[model samples]
Target: MTRHLPARTCRDCGRNRPNHGRGLCRGCWLRQWRATNGRYDVATGTGMGGPGIPKTAADIAARLEDYAFLRALNVRRLDIAARLGVSYRTLNRYDARLRQQQDTA
Candidate 1:
């Protein structure tokens, strides 16, 4: 008899994306969402004052650096935002973005 692997689905969008993160579909997850505290500017992509668009390794690296550091310390979401001077919700969004960036790279 042959064994069969279970199929997985994307958490967001719900479009049956090969499992990646917790309940996050690649389509919806691939796109940047609001930052940790749930804030955004429809007119521009500047959430926390970096760039209008995602450019330069520094921008991405800066976000990733914060995420990795916080994760390593096992800091609470709220604490992380407070320490990093950002919204908790924004931190959540940033964490996701960092994960995606790492995955792609």
Candidate 2:
């Protein structure tokens, strides 16, 4: 005997088809994945920007300032990253860069 699964409607297109998770059908899911350049998180359904914080000097300075303030409060690295809207790896890079500058000065 074969099991018959009920068709699921995609949240984006509303077409009935097999679900690919995140309440989206395969086609819609693939569309979203490509749209985000594969940054789509299937589990959280959010795309944390691939490159992370903008590369502008002012933006980097501002984020680093925020990072320092948050660090002074003893915030966890993960929390700091989320608050800064960056990934943990990016935060680590920022931290290292700041340390390097401080060392040189």
Candidate 3:
């Protein structure tokens, strides 16, 4: 006979959804992951200043240079994202920003 286990609630949101991991629901878990990961501006499609991320204009310029260099080397976008410690979507945003900057310059 199989034993029934008690239902678990999310520790962070106190929701009745199924636990994902660390006693958090899926939404809570994803929020936590994003918070701990790199900073990103969803609406603006830009990287936000935070720990271990580019903040100043010079820093952003340096990152763009690195990204351009990687592209020149024909590195796969996914590989570049991994090397830069950012998500693929964020890398796409960076690419767009780079293009915009190039167009204006």
Candidate 4:
């Protein structure tokens, strides 16, 4: 028989319920993992940007998917690309895509 753990608020999702204190329940956390494709962890905050910061290619993809505002936000694309471990040309592509998306939406 499985033991029932106590409930708690998820620090990440901020939902009240039976959470195991990884700040999220197994299901929500699993969904988050799927969001990250199990390669990166935005929760523990690991990536190229720094400690608890996600900036790698995979991480960038995940962040872009989750936060459209980030795409529209005015930022130095070169700098962003430098930090993201990608080239300026690639950054331009991303920017173009974002602009197209923003324009359409």
Candidate 5:
């Protein structure tokens, strides 16, 4: 005799589906992951800049200024990255480029 397990429902929205993780369905799991891992707009269900931040020099410069302002106040780089809605690596690259520019100036 084979025993069958009942399908799992999302722990959040309660829609019946296979469990994605943490007892959540796929959509709920995605939402939860995005909310915690990125600057996810709840209403739109997407990230701040869709895919990633723009790579234009002006954009980078503005981000660098923000990073510097936060740093002057003694904010941690990880916290600043979260507050700015960018990844730590991206912020690090921006900082590196800013430093190079300052060195050359």
Candidate 6:
């Protein structure tokens, strides 16, 4: 006897996909995973990470540079936040803080 499988669509993007049991396609799942800093919890549909703060000046500078790069790419902030494993609000806050610091210098 042979079992049959049905094609499914990703819940996020509505793209045809395999049954991954999470209702999300590979690419969508990966985006979620990356947004969560590689800590996606399927059961809860959530992500976990440490405090959202740059530990050093170098780290802050690097992140600012990364933000600039993302801006140049014209990527949406939501996408950028997901790609960087942060919340949209957090991203906005960080950007505001960084911009303020830059202006003061």
| Best lDDT among the predictions, by candidate number | 2
Each candidate structure's TM-score, on Cα atoms with residue i matched to residue i, is 0.40, 0.51, 0.46, 0.32, 0.49, 0.42
Question: Candidate 6 overall Cα lDDT vs. reference?
Answer: 0.66
lDDT-based ranking, best first? 2, 3, 5, 6, 1, 4
Candidate 5 achieves a global lDDT of 0.72
Candidate 1 residue runs with Cα over 4 Å from true position: 1-60
Every candidate's lDDT: 0.59, 0.73, 0.72, 0.58, 0.72, 0.66
lDDT of 6 by residue, 42-82 (tens): 11213454445545878766766787689779998766766
Q: Please tell me which model should have the higher TM-score, number 5 or number 6.
A: 5
Q: Which stretches of candidate 4 lie over 4 Å from their true place?
A: 1-60, 63-75
Off by over 4 Å in 2: 1-54
Worst 10 residues of 2 by lDDT: 38-47
lDDT of 4 by residue, 1-105 (tens): 997977888777777767764679767887776665523222222333345433588876764553344445755654455455554455556667677887999
Can you write out model 2's per-residue Cα lDDT over 1-105, one digit (the tens) per residue? 965656898889989887777999878888787776633122121244334333698888998999999999999877777676666667768889899989999
Q: Given candidate 3, what's the lDDT at residue 68?
A: 87
C-alpha RMSD for every candidate: 13.1, 7.3, 7.2, 13.1, 6.8, 11.5
CA lDDT, candidate 4, residue 70: 45
Model 6 residue 63 CA deviation in Å: 1.5
By the TM-score metric, which is better: model 2 or model 4? 2
Model 3 ranges off by over 4 Å: 1-54
- The true-versus-predicted C-alpha distance at residue 99 of model 5, in Å, is 1.8
* Residue 6 C-alpha lDDT in model 3: 51
Candidate 1 lDDT over residue span 28-96, tens digit each: 554544444344322123355555453587865686688778889897766666555555556667878
Put down candidate 3 lDDT per residue, 10-65, tens digits, no spaces.
Answer: 89989787777799888999988876775433322234443454479887677678
| Model 6 segments more than 4 A misplaced | 1-54
Query: Which residue pairs clash in candidate 4?
Result: 45-52
